[model samples]
Target: MALLYIIIIVAFIDTFSQLPIIAPFAISLGATPMLVGIIIGLYSFSNIIGNIVSGYWIDRSGPKIVLCVGMIFVGIVLFFYSIVTTPQQLVYVRFFHGLAGGLIVPAAFTYLGSRKTSESKGRIMAFSGASVGIAAIAGPALGAIISGRFGYDYLFFMLTVLMIGCAVLAIFFVKELQVISSKAASPQITSLKLTKPMLFSYTSIFLLMFTLGILTFALPLKVEELQLSAELTGPLLSVFGLVAILIFVLPTNVLFDKWNNVHLMTIGLVIICGALVSLSLSASFIHLLLAMMIYGGGFAFIFPSTSATVVEHSGEAKRGKAFGLFYACFSFGVITGSFFAGALAVSPSFLFLIGALCLLLIVILLYLFSWKPVI
Candidate 1:
C-alpha cells in the first residue's frame, strides 16, 4: 500500500510537472498561442491510444508488470523531452507520454478493486486519491521553481528521476496475483462479470474528464488574457487542485458512502455547470478562484464516485478490463476536450458555456435513463 502511494505520487507529479512551465516553455521554443494550445492538446491525443491498449494488457497480464513497464516508458520519454527543440518533437513526446500515463490509473485501480472487500478498496483508493492531491498541490510549484531557475531541461530531469523511482518501487514491492479463471476460482473467491452498470460508470468518468480537459486548456488562456503574471497562474491552479484533494479525500467520500452514487454524480454535474457559468463571468483573480473551488469540488465528488461504481459493477475476472475501459474513456475525453477547445479558441466564454450545456445534457441523459447507483 505504501508502495502504491509512492507510485501514485510519482505519476501525479510526472503528469502535472509541465503545467506550470508550458506557456513559458512554448514561448522559449518560439511557439505562438495557437501552437502552444496544440502542444498541450497533443498530450491528450496520445492518451486515447495508451488507455485502451494498456487497459486490455493489464486485464490479461495483471497490473504489476504493466505498471513497471509504464513507469519505465514514461521515464525514458521524459528524458527525451529534455531535448525537444520543435513543437512537432514535443508533440510526439507528449503523445507517447500520454500513452504511458494511460496504463497507471487503471492498473492501480484494478489492483485495488480486485482485493477481497469494498472497505479495503475504499481505504486504499482514498489514500491513492490523497496522493494525487498532494502531487497536484506540489508539482506545479516545483516545476515553476525549476523552470524559473534551472530551465526546462532540469525540470524534465527531475521528472525522469521520479519516474525511474516509481519503476524501481514497482519492481521491488508490488506483488502480482495469479490470473485465475472463474472455473478455477477457490470457494472463497466470488465470480464476477461485467455489465451495463460498469459501462455507465465509465461513461460518467469520460464525460467528467472531457469537461475537465476543456477547463484546463481554457483556464490558462483566460488567466493570460487577464494579464496575470505567469507566477500567479501556478498558484491559482494549485488552489484548484488543493481544493479538489481536500474535498475528494474526506467530504466527498463521506457523501459517496451516505448517498447513491448516481445521485452524487448528478449533483456533481450540476455543481460543474454552476462553476462553468461562474467562470464565464470571472474577470479577476478572486472570481477565478471562486469558480475553480466550485469546479474542483465537483471534480472531487465525481472522480471517486465514478471509479468506485466501476469497481462495484464489474466482476472479478473483468475488473481489469472495466478499469481499462474507464481510463480509456477518461483519456479519450481529455483528448477530445483539448482538441475541441483548441479549435474553438476564438471565444473562451463560448467554450465554457458549451461545457455547461454539455453537463446539462449529461444530467438529462442520466435522468432519462434513471441510472441506478452502482454502490
Candidate 2:
C-alpha cells in the first residue's frame, strides 16, 4: 500500500512540476500565446487516447504489468523534453509524454479500487487524494526552484531517474491482482450505460479540471504580469495543495464518508466559483494565496466524492474501464480549458473571470435539475 501511494506521488510530481514551467518553456522556444496553449493542451489530448487503451489493457492483464510499462514509457519520454529545441518539437514531445502518462493513473487507481470494499471507499480515496495533494504541494515548488537554479534540462533528467526508479520498485514490490472468474455473473455486468451518479461524477471532474486548466495556463502569466519572479508561481500554486491536504488528513475527512456526494460536490463547485472570481480580482501575492486556499477547499470536497463515486458504482469487472473513461473526461476538460483559454487571448484577470462564469453555470444546472444523492 505504501509503495502504491509512493508511485502515485511520483507520477503526479512529474505532472505538477511541469505546470509552472511548461508555458514558459514553450514561450522560450518562440511559441505565441495561442501556440503555448496548444502545446499545453496537446498532452491532455493524447492522454485521452492513452487512458482508454490503458484501461482496456489493465482489465485484461491486471494492473501490475500496465503500471510498470506505463512508468517506463513515461520515463523514456521525459528524455525528449531535454532534447527539443523548437516549439514544434516540444509539441510532439508533449503529445507522447501525455500518452505515456495516461497509462499510469488508471492503473494505480484500479489497483486501489480493486482492493478496497465499498464501505471504506471514501476514506481510502481520501488517502489517495492526500497522496496527490502531497505531490501538488511539493512538485511545483521543487520544479520552480530546480529550474530556476539548475535549468529545465536538469529537471527532466531528474524526473527520468525518479520514474525509472519507481518503475523498478513497482516491478519488485507491487502484487498482481488475481483475475477472478465467476459462473453466475449478472446480465447487466456487460451493460455499457452510465448511471446518473457516474454522469454526475464525470461532469463534476470535467468541470473541476477545466477550471484547473485555466489556472494552469493563466496563473504563471499572472505572476509575470505583476512583475514577480516566475518562482513565485510554483509556491503560489502550492498554497492550494497545502489547504487540500489538511482537509484530506484532518478530522474533516470524515465528511467524505458521512455526507451526500452530490451535496458535497455542489458546495465544492460553488466555492470553486467564488475562488475563480477572487482570482480574477487579485492584485497581490496575498490575494492570490487566499483565492488558492479557497480553490483547495473546493478541490478537497470534489476529489474524494468523485473518486468514491466510481468505486461505489462500478463492479470489479468494469472498474478499470470506468476509471479510464472518467479520466478521459478529465483530460478532455483540461484540453478544452487550455486551448480555449489561450485562443480567447484575454488577460489573466478576464480568463479567471470567465472560468468563474463557467463554474457558476455548472452549479446552476445542478440545481435546475434538482439532483439527489444517488446512493
What are the per-residue Cα lDDT tens digits for candidate 1 across 1-375? 667777878887887778768777877878888888777766766776777777678756888888889889989998997898887787788788888887777787777777664464444555566787788888877887898899889999989988888898789888896675646765334344445455556677777777877887888777878887656666666776788777766644666666676766777778889998888889898998899888877777677677778777776666777777777787778777777787774767778988888878877886556555556
Global lDDT of each candidate:
0.76, 0.87
Deviation from native of the Cα of residue 345 in model 2, angstroms: 4.6
Best by lDDT: 2
Off by over 4 Å in 2: 23-37, 84-89, 117-119, 180-184, 188-192, 220-231, 345-347, 367-375
TM-score of 2: 0.89
Best by TM-score: 2
Listing every candidate in turn, what is its Cα RMSD in Å to the true structure after a full C-alpha superposition?
A: 3.5, 2.9
